[model samples]
Target: ETRHLTPQERVARGKAARADVPRSSHAEFVPPPKRTDPVEIIERQSATRVPELVPIRYSRMSEAPFRFYRGAASIMAADLAETPRSGFRVQCCGDAHMLNFRLLASPERRLMFDLNDFDETLPGPWEWDVKRLSASLVIAGRANGFDDAERARIVSSTVRSYREAMIRFAGTGNLDVWYAKIDADLLESLLASRLHGTKRGQKNLTRAMAKARTRDSLQAFDKLTETVDGRPRIAADPPLLVPAGDLLPDVERSALERQFRGLVERYGRTLASDRRTLLADYRLADVARKVVGVGSVGTRCWIFLLLGRDDQDPLFLQAKEADVSVLAAHVGTSRYPNQGERVVSGQRLMQATSDIFLGWERVEGIDGKQRDFYVRQLRDWKGIAMPERMRPRDMQAFGQLCGVTLARAHARSGDRIAIAAYLGGGDSFDRALTTFAEAYADQNERDHQALIDAVRAGRLPAEELPAA
Candidate 1:
């Protein structure tokens, strides 16, 4: 058993840690010596991905600086390895950029704002996530034509919210802090305050939340599935959504069904007894290869369409391949043999509410290798805040929301009192991070150009997609 300390003692310890590494030290951004080539790092990650679809990953990444940053977690990891730290750690969202923070439905059917991606989650310095979020604000602000002052304010707002939220958690009861979450209503209220009390702002907010509510499994079912010869199956959208029959020519459909059933059973065993019982009512109807988000483009992701009693009641489950987190090389390997377990464990530790059917399993690939994957409900009111659509004020408020959400997640696993003390009750930490964000955004642009240069030089293949 571990000894308990008074809250004051924890705060003192955190303040002491700051003396060893000053709060201002975080402002500096230095690339480590003999840094590995970012393009080469991307190639290494792509080696395990589907061979023909690898080009799509590069193509998506080459779109803009923010998009490039999303896929360049490996590059940022190497750079962050050289930054100063206070040594406190949390289950960091190794790639917690703006786009990764989104809306998802809680078990009670309430929409929540939380970190939605966890392909690269791991226990590491909490600053890594904050820095990535800060840089994302600057990069995305530039895309939106926000001036430097506006960009700096957005970054500062993010850090300020994080600092304040951490202090709030520190003062609260342990259980209270653990149970805390940023729900859609609370988030909308906060965003309204940031909108300067405008009627149109509230109207826009109501409209967006309403749209998010409509993006559940039923909506996805209508858009992604169709009847083929009186049987409903997932449609084929070549290079994006391909059925198992199209993906594996040699394997028979019956054999594929057996393999999937066995793997799903393995996944179900990892869920709670009640959840497994709830899942047992649904039978697998179809499976498809699904290309997902910017960073996760090349990974092996599959969608399973499950039906209960009749076609009207449906459930969609996504099985996404999990590999060693980008932070693993710098922060040490996870104890779990299965990487999917690492992702699922970290997500549970950080999120106040998680998906009902979340679980993990290792399955043999068509290439004869055993790969780890985590499964979850595919569309539980999932929605993203588009950077291109948000005004400067909206982005600032969104930044603060992400900051607060990230702080709550860190507080669950790290010492809240200590972190709050280290940050102090001032603007020093926020200003320092703002400086870092500005510098790093410049670096991201250069790195993005390098990828473009590679494409121009015929070093990498890329294709442009039509804008939405």
Candidate 2:
């Protein structure tokens, strides 16, 4: 709609937005009176999760402050509701933390860096995503032994990258902005230049790209599946991955598979006709309950082994339960009928490319209650950077990369010119976020300690894992 606006006009609008919600106002974080209990928020989230897996979720969340931050997206969402923000809204990855970005394969087999989690995605204030991401960097930097000043500098640099990227995108053609992507080769080359001939950085980038290439469906099959009775089946790793047969009695196994086949058929209806035809060639081989990631642990996640023509040709699909987004109560309920469809819609709009098999369906659970889920390839050359182990310099580069990628994502669905203008060509927004991030990081540590105290009081059960 603002396509008719001149560049200067868009910039003026951004400045006006800043005046309405001053950049300095963003540096504040005060828990409102009658603020919701973080633990109670977690308990509410556990309602529909598998009862046995809930404790595991607690265990993972208790691993470290950073891990706790990962699982505390709902808590942050509630808090973000009370923060100051510009009236501007965009399709946001509501849990836009540093850990959520990953390198994954597009349909064309090329690797790309993008937002990899969308469980809490919804249209909300752009600052919420930036705050969450910046705060996470502060927490992570602290855990890695970085000083407060260093953490602040890193956060500031990241916000600056975001501001500059938005400005650059604003001046580009609409189609060019739409096509913008951080391809693997291009990103590695750019990082090398930024590193100024740092051997460690170049080596790490090369190794990561090589590692990503070896992480396709076939590689996952080798590691996660085994031959049983001359047939390929998912290997059971109790408490983490339990095959369907291990959980269900013999009588119910056939019924479960039948239900799954029907579910797959219904899911197919959501895809394009050609993709549906492609899926028709594959038949289900096995299914297993999979515990994945700190935030997603308790949620219902299943890995399916599908065979095409022969045992060698296999496709693994994951059906992850999609609940109401954490942002829903704060912003507004999604327009989509199914929560799963809401996740899929937001992901497609925000990502430059997506897995071809991505789709959604609604199914009745064993409890006879309906649940919504989105499906996607379980492994398509996916790789994640270990921020915890990254050196200070590498972390700064990584932070800058994440910030630029996030800006691109926001630009796809928002007024880039206005956002760029709001940020301006100055350090004001960056400095404000640095202050906010440091303050929030302190709050995060206190919240983490609260969970420890809860465990001591026997109010919560946690199986503490050895710290990384």
Candidate 3:
């Protein structure tokens, strides 16, 4: 077992890391001579996914450089593997792009901002998450037509926020750090001076929070289900949302229900006793295959509709496939053999709180292939930020919020004292990351163009859906 170091020793170790890999070394990003073709990476991932949906993933990514970045985590992971590291590893949200941070309701029904997507979660170098986030800010800023100087300011401020937050966590008590969270009130306070200063800004923020609260299981039931033969069933929206019955016309509905019920019971075993008991109250009413986010597109995802006390009391649980994290190739495979367990464990470790229903199970598909899946409530009070709508100042404030949030997540799993010590009370790390962000953003644009070119040349099939 590794012996725990004293606080002074930890600080010295951090300083020593700085000496071995100078902080400024992070600013560079020269694509290695034999760098793998980014398109090939996407194609390899597509091979394991539902083939029909792979084109949708390519289509979504081809929309813009920022959108492409969202779906290109594997590509960036390869690049990040080549970057300098501080030799510290944490349970990382391997794809820590800006959009992944959002508002989610805690078990208490209190809204809080946190990292939501854990499809790519794994233990890896802390710098990977930080650099991915920084680069995302630059890419999004460029999409918004921000000048170079403005983008640099945004990236620097954000990195500085992360550095400063780590310092705070380093001095805080372990219990306090564990319980720390950015609740709705705290979020308002943080953005009060900038994002909530004007009446319009305040109105927008208030409206969004109020809207998020209404987006629960009941709301999803109303929006995504319809009554058929006096029974509720998940509605179909082809190539995006296809009801199980429609997707498999040959299978009997009763047989499908039996299979899903068995899956649910098995999944419930992974939850706590109380939660398992709670889950037992509902009966599986319907199931649907749904296409989710950009990177997640093509992955096998299913939504289970459960009803209690008549169709009115509904619960939607999403069971998404969990493959090996992109970072696994560079870092190491998760100790948990099941990828779903890796995601669930990483989320529980990195977040102050996670969905109570969060659990994992292995399922044998219709093709007789077993796949690992992590399950969670389909819709709670979830709110996402649209980077395309953000102004320069708004993005800067949002970036700072994301930065502090990422630091807190890292603090929960990594050595806060060591990381804070490495950062010190200077802007060196922040400035270096800002430089790196711009360089990586340039590289991202080139990769984005490459995808578009591939699509045009018929090297990759891309199905363009109408804008939402």
Candidate 4:
């Protein structure tokens, strides 16, 4: 082309550039539907859309041990993308990470290992719930800086424990399986198994016992309250103690109260009549914003302290925002007609021991608010023994314990007999999962990076973002 163009040539170039351009710079970049229940549109997206989850899976790629775990979760989600599952779908704690399993008081006043988290509860495949739990073990190992080889061995031991437990359960009497539990004595035995003849390993076991001992109700009580005139009031620690966020406008508060009043009646069906009657007498003390978990940062979480007669007889309750399951997007089906019902039902199905006061309600709020939420006791001896807190040998043993626990929980909800047969006479599935976990963890890191990028670009809301 000529360096010095004619006036007509220059005019032509300008005209072409103008023609190619659209009028407006602003445009909407819509996301694909994560869950499409018409009624759930108003619920907080943090309750469902877990982009942080994907990123978490991806973030550990910088290190060698975690390199393999990157997309392990995404792959687990994909492998569980489609499968025929038990028809008896109930609201399940969608991400049943081994850490989420903890010591809690049963109705009989017996302390038992039970699931304590229900933030992402939704109705969906039983397998999806378990696989998510399994992958968590692998990711957790990487987070603690375990090497690939160590992580692989831990994952193997974990799955093996689950498979072996299922086999044992299938052959044993029902009552025996129900009676199966891990107590302090069982934990001691597990430590002995892990320690073998090593003095170093024995020391690790002692340390674990000391750590676990410090995590009882007394420990929780100290942190949960300070004695005020020999009476208990929630400690004023910003949002932690304060159950409600800010004073709701009278119009909004009245609507919330009205909906919650109906909630007691609807909640009755989720439990036995006696407990329902007990909850009916309870009065709401206050409601406040609450943040929970590394993944569910922006969800509309609130704590409501209920008082039956006075403050000492306090019952803490949480109404985490409920949304459709992530698995629903891939499966192409909603497990239940009502999302609130879906959550409540799944909790009943999956949890061997459940909070007596679990229930749900739909409240009408201002600022385009009409949201449904599932409610449950905030803390009932909820304490988790972190994996990193254990020695290598003890970690292996603990992994097995978690596996057995997972299998038992699954057996309760799904066809354990059939699953046992499917896994007969082989460790191939265990090995395959180990491989899958390592490989996919790498993928997760990449996805996490995409999330970090999105956050930096201000593509997502600030509340929705978590510290990487």
In the range 1-468, model 4's lDDT, one tens digit per residue, is 321455345334433432332211101112225523211221233334333333332232222323323222233344454333333232446666666676665566445555666545555555455555556666677778788888778878887787788778766655666666665556557657766757766665556455554554344445665565875544555432343324354546566656555655575566678987888787765455565554443446666656677665666677776765545655554556666766777666556667787877776655566677787777655556666565556567767777777777666655455456555547755776676556545545544555445546754333323322
Cα lDDT of candidate 3 equals 0.92
Flag the better candidate by lDDT, 1 or 4: 1
TM-score list, all predictions: 0.97, 0.97, 0.98, 0.71
Backbone clashes in model 2, listed as residue pairs: none
List candidate 2 stretches off by more than 4 Å.
1-9, 464-468
What is the per-residue lDDT of model 3 for residues 235-258, given as tens digits with 9 covering 90 to 100? 999989999999899999999999
Off by over 4 Å in 4: 1-79, 82-93, 118-130, 173-269, 332-335, 461-468
Tell me the whole-model lDDT of each prediction, alpha carbons only: 0.89, 0.88, 0.92, 0.56
For residues 300-358, could you state the per-residue lDDT of candidate 2 as single tens digits? 99889999989999999999999999999999999998999999999998898999999
Higher-TM-score candidate of 1 and 4: 1
Find the candidate with the highest TM-score and give its number. 3
Best by lDDT: 3
The true-versus-predicted C-alpha distance at residue 356 of model 1, in Å, is 0.4
* Reference-based lDDT, residue 9, model 4: 55
Q: How close is candidate 1 to the true structure, as a TM-score?
A: 0.97
Decoy 2 TM-score against native: 0.97
Root mean square deviation (Cα) for candidate 4: 16.8
Q: Which ten residues in a row have the lowest lDDT in candidate 2?
A: 459-468
**Local error of candidate 3 at residue 5 (angstroms):** 1.4
